[model samples]
Target chain A: MSQFFTAAVLTSTVAAGIALATPFLLAALGETLGQRSGVINLGVDGIMLLAAFATYYVALRTDDVLLAILAGMGTGLLMGVVTAAVSVTLKAEQGISGIGVYLFGLGFSDLLFQKLVGTPLPITTPPQVGIPLLDQIPVLGGMFFDQSPLVYLAFLLVPVVAFVLNHTTYGLKIRAAGENPAAADSLGVSVARIRWSTVLLGCTFAGLAGASLLLYDGIFQVNLTQSEGFIAVALVYFGAWRPSGVMAGSLLYGLVGAIILTWKSLGIIPLSGSDLAATAPAVITVLALLFVARRFRQPAALGKPYEREA
Target chain B: MQRPVHRRALPALLAVAALVAAACGSSSSPAPVSSAAAPASVAPAASSSVTPAPAATAPASAAAAASGATSATTLKVALVAPSAVNDLAFTQSMVEALNSIKARYNLQVAISDNQFVVSTAANVIRSYASQGYNLVIAHGSQYGSTLQQLAPQFPNVSFAWGTAGSTFNQPNIFAYQANSNEGGYVQGAMAAMLSTSKVLGVIGPIAVGDAKLYVDGFCAGAKSVDPTISCIPVYTGSFSDVSLFATAAKTFVSNKADVLTGTAQAVVGAIGVARADNLPWFGTQWTQVSLAPHNVVSSQIYNWAPILEQIITEIRGGKLGGATYTVTLGNGGETIQFNSGFNLPANVKAKADELIKGITDGLVNVPQ
Candidate 1:
């Protein structure tokens, strides 16, 4: 236990926490955007599964991380179109329609994996790139700056998403569409168009999240996402549908996961009891949700299909 | 509009319910159910005796007798697995072993994969037994209770299960386990000798059964080689979360572990991390060399054909269950396959071979 508290162990655990947070951060940020625009895509996990498989398949064949990521994004975008078609064009209930998307993504991804990559194979992950001056900092440098390029991109998207949600005209239109679609339509905001675009954008982020997770380890398996997509969706509620809040929730979940592993390795928790430790992230998430549920209000039109008054 | 919303709510509720069900069933601990009370009509000697009286003069007994009278018996075996048959981990190991012996034993095999739900598994097991299959192999520890209940119901049907030691004192059930620690000890000894940083890491999926035994043996082997060497083992509390395993591997690497090993299907993630970093990796349950040709050191392969053959032979000869079997390094059931692509030092290779010989010759005892 004494050996586990060394600086090296602590630093590595922090760095791992950041790495572990990347997928959740990316997916939650996307979910935040979708929910803010009055759409809820519960199929985020299924989309991640499909995207992860696509990324892994491309990486195995071409060994090009960029191409693999594009493949994942392409898969996500395609699923997004289907989701929009069902929820936006057909005016299907967003809550149930998203479940259809989720099931489709889950079953289709598993089938494709069985038909194509029948066995688990190893592929090369993206190389780590340390930022010049930032990586030289005392302890923070290694934890934040000395990460894979994907990790940097995921973090960068958070601020970018926050800015887009809070300051842009499109952002205002999205909010209007969610809060009161009839008024937004009367104001010439094109509610359907805004909702469709936001859902697509959200799914694109989910796809990238899948790519990041696959590239982190350079391996792929069925059910690889392990309900992380659901957690990302939950983070949207936990964060009050705010980009910054989502970031906080994602980081907390990721750090809790890393801490549990570190604690078990250090013998702070016995091996037989480690399963209880594994529940820390979910328990914390539930507690956070309970605390925040009373304070935050969801978009008025969230999970409701918007129909133009004839 | 109101009707549509109300109808949609049902599906939305159902979808949430299904997701919750999946999450709950995903990695449930094998429930401990006391073995079913023995029925007075069934004789305990039915499993051990060569020429026992037929306990059930039913159609199932007639079918069994008819099959046994044929010189080339068509041995029908059904396997219930918790994950996909091609998971490339525990399930795949058994599937491959069963496939290898199918043709030689005149076996007709049926598999029910992804039966993570215990109730679903119970139904499948009973279905197979009622269909008069010669042997029903419950391929997961989670199926112990289901097997115990179903084994006694179908007195003529021979049942086998494991990574467990107990046969429930039933004559018709065969329990099989792997002495995995023997191979883990050998791998740890090799890992300790080869590690330059004198720090070894193990990523285990759920600290129980073979996973726990293997990790314990690894630590013991590493400590015996060098008391000062750091042997850190972490359980990810999941058998399917590849991302967690990958993150754990990166943490280990970050902390200066030069040699790494892990078990379960999720270990693909850990092996990927090791391969990318050029760290030596040890594997168990299956050959993982295809995942990392240059980085994988050796794999303790589970060769189940020998045990499968023995169980089939026993069932044919009138011994049904009341017996336990184990696969070990001393037997051909468990063999160490070194990755030919990884260039190992001559002395290290010689030492590994010597250790294998020492264990097989009864010179070394591996602690469980």
Candidate 2:
């Protein structure tokens, strides 16, 4: 309806939609790379949280945004490696191990925040920077062009990820490992190394997603990544496990978020029904999963742990 | 020997390196909390002196008091709330209050935000207890049952909470209740008088006990003023979803409602709708009027600083936790703050002032 789909509403919706999608896009794209190397990281959410709280503390202590982001990435990489070592080397269940990593990261990061900042502190975040010409264009300008640099990176990552996965030799080896670890191992490829590296790379992206949220929101509150990790998981499936598809998925989710925000901003949708629209991303992801399940095939050894015993 | 050297030292070195790298990262600097609180007893002193209130940063006095009361070397306090510490409204206020107390009194405080997960509640308590926390305070009404169960095991540690008239019997556990409904009633009275259309709407999160107090108090306050006023209420059953709050607000505005009030945290969405539609609204807990300066008529502000400072002072003093302390209008626990810049009608201000006096005097009872 024109009432819901007004130009102002659409543009704002797209902007907010992208903002909401950055975390999911970054996490899912990272996961896609990991899965390609036969490593499934369910701990993406936990890793994001670890990065978020760590970044918050570091930023609070040092007042450096770049350092915070790097800290987040490093935390994510460590979490990824832990999950990878247990699942890839020890042959532990990937899903279970990833869950453990998530739980640990959440509790550990939260404790660190409590210890450092003393529960709640009034901290001010950096202002978002925009390019000169693009940021001033009415609706799209403020929404798309005048965003935090991480949002643009999320979009840039889609093609970069596609190029890496589809064209690069490392990408080929990762795919080979995911498709048939034993065959790849027979070819003298260290399946363990590939899986560990992929998971760490994915975790770094996940960490970036967490950083985007804290940096953009201007404050780091508790449960800062509430269900965002689940959304990232959903994006992986929504994108049909492809980098381009994941980007589309993030856009769709971000679009819904932006629409609800814009519609409310314009007084188009009544306030009572706005919560339903907020549920749109999660619901759409579920529905998209159903569609993808029927249309596409998941990697053969997606969740199975790789062991060298045989 | 070679394997042992790589295994033992490398991971330790990496961990240390990671810790150093992490220590260097992050953005945003916090303002020093010198002016965050002005003691309740003191007059508005000089403008720029960063003196935190006596209730907030009286560590020397608290230390003297604690030494007189107990021999405990470390005073540990834990915060377990239904929502995250960054909720920015109810829970955030509590967290800030507790942290201020901790900083002033030099008490060790641990906070568990999403302890809304029932399984995690007991686990969190046990972990904190194992670490020898002296006092634990749970923020939401939902944690009443959880606190009751855990208080016995950690008898040496005191547990306190804000619940709906819920009490803990353990020598160590206490409850803290506030005159929240009184604040709700004031907003109601304000919204009732300010409405141009005499039709008001409320978009609440859920139909819970505390939320019901807000809704019922608002309705009662409105009815006390205008016998012929119509009030609409809707519970969307969620707090985090802002779009829903907005949609409800738009509907109310579209339906000729000129005033709105709600208990939903995401009610910011609803306020945005009100601002865009040019209808005045009221908020709760924090000064949400800052969101839409023109549209927000008034906010019922809750002063957690007083309650927090008092509890911390009492602990530092010779007193073991008292049976639940309930703050009322007479005690300056809660008050309705109007946008002083807004030129509200004289009659409206007079009626609100009269009601506040009556409430403080116990002549008027706000419905809960």
Estimate, for each residue in A85-180, the C-alpha lDDT of model 1 and write its tens digit: 767766666776677677666666766776688777777787889999999988778778888998899889988998998899998998998899
DockQ of each: 0.39, 0.09
What 10-residue stretch in candidate 1 chain B is worst by lDDT? B44-53
Error of 1 at B226 (Å): 1.6
Docking class of 2: incorrect
TM-score of each: 0.88, 0.65
Distance from true location, Cα of A238 in model 2, Å:
2.4
Worst 10 residues of 1 chain A by lDDT: A102-111
lDDT per residue as tens, model 2, A1-310: 4655555545555566677678889988998988777777777887888888777777777888889888888888877777666666656556766666666665666556655664344234555578799888887786689666788888898999899888998888888888888788889888878888888789899888877766655345445676677678777877777899888888787666555444543445554575565566568768877887678767766876665542
> How does candidate 1 score on lDDT?
0.80
- Residue-level lDDT of model 1, residues B172-232, one tens digit each, is 8888788888889989988999998998989898877788888888887887788888897
Candidate 2 local Cα displacement, residue B133, angstroms: 14
Using TM-score, give the best candidate's number.
1
